[model samples]
Target: MSENDIERLQEVLRDFAKERDWEQFHSPKNLIMALMGEVGELSEIFQWLTDSEASHLEGKVKNRAREEIADVLLYLLRLSDVLDIDLIEAAHDKLEVNRQKYPVAVFKGSSAKYNEIKD
Candidate 1:
């Protein structure tokens, strides 16, 4: 998604919370907790599914997954806004760090952690 999309969503979430008088409850810690809850809900959709089934969700299950994912995104965006973090930039920076930690030459086709990858 574009930065504009993220900014727009942030504005929408800000207005939503303000309109509901929920700013006080939107602290970073609370938002993170809510995010984790959403994540759990999302995970539940695939809890007993085979890998193929989880990858190819359909009908009601897919719709539920969509809603749960939206919840996760909303809570994450709210938390980032509360903490004054630019999520896009932070993600880019983290990706760069990960690239350095797990170089293509050493990490290709490997599922090992960075520390476990042989030189």
Candidate 2:
């Protein structure tokens, strides 16, 4: 229930883990592995469910999915911190690069990667 900046939120999480001496377990490689595991957990929620069925779980079942997703974010944030990656800055930078590679007119309706555009 706090309106904090991303850095503040990350600090809070880091502090919580530090309080439990969990930082020793948070190496960059381990954090990345945990992030992947969390992603798999989140994916399990809709593994076989139809889009309509998955959509219908918006209220109750979503809690499980949210928990898994939160885990993914937590580990990703930790990984970014450990690797000295500024996620927001990197995201903004990548957005600009992607725009060059995938101009809006070419990518607005398609999911193709940069090299897929017809010359």
Instruction: Judging by TM-score against the true structure, name the best candidate.
Output: 1
Task: Evaluate all candidate structures by whole-model CA lDDT and list the values in order.
Answer: 0.92, 0.83
Off by over 4 Å in 2: 1-4
Q: Compute each candidate's TM-score over C-alphas.
A: 0.97, 0.87
Off by over 4 Å in 1: none
Query: Which candidate number maximizes lDDT?
Result: 1
- Return the clash pairs for model 2, or none: none
What would the per-residue lDDT of candidate 1 be over residues 1-119, giving only the tens digit for each residue? 89899999999999999999999898778888899999999999999999999999999999999999999999998899889899999999999999899889888998999988655
> What is the C-alpha lDDT profile of model 2 across 1-119, one tens digit per residue?
23246677688888988999999999988888888888998998999999899878876578998888788878877888778788888888999987798888878989888778787
For every candidate, C-alpha RMSD to the true structure in Å? 0.8, 2.3
Candidate no. 2 TM-score: 0.87
- RMSD in Å for candidate 1, one decimal? 0.8
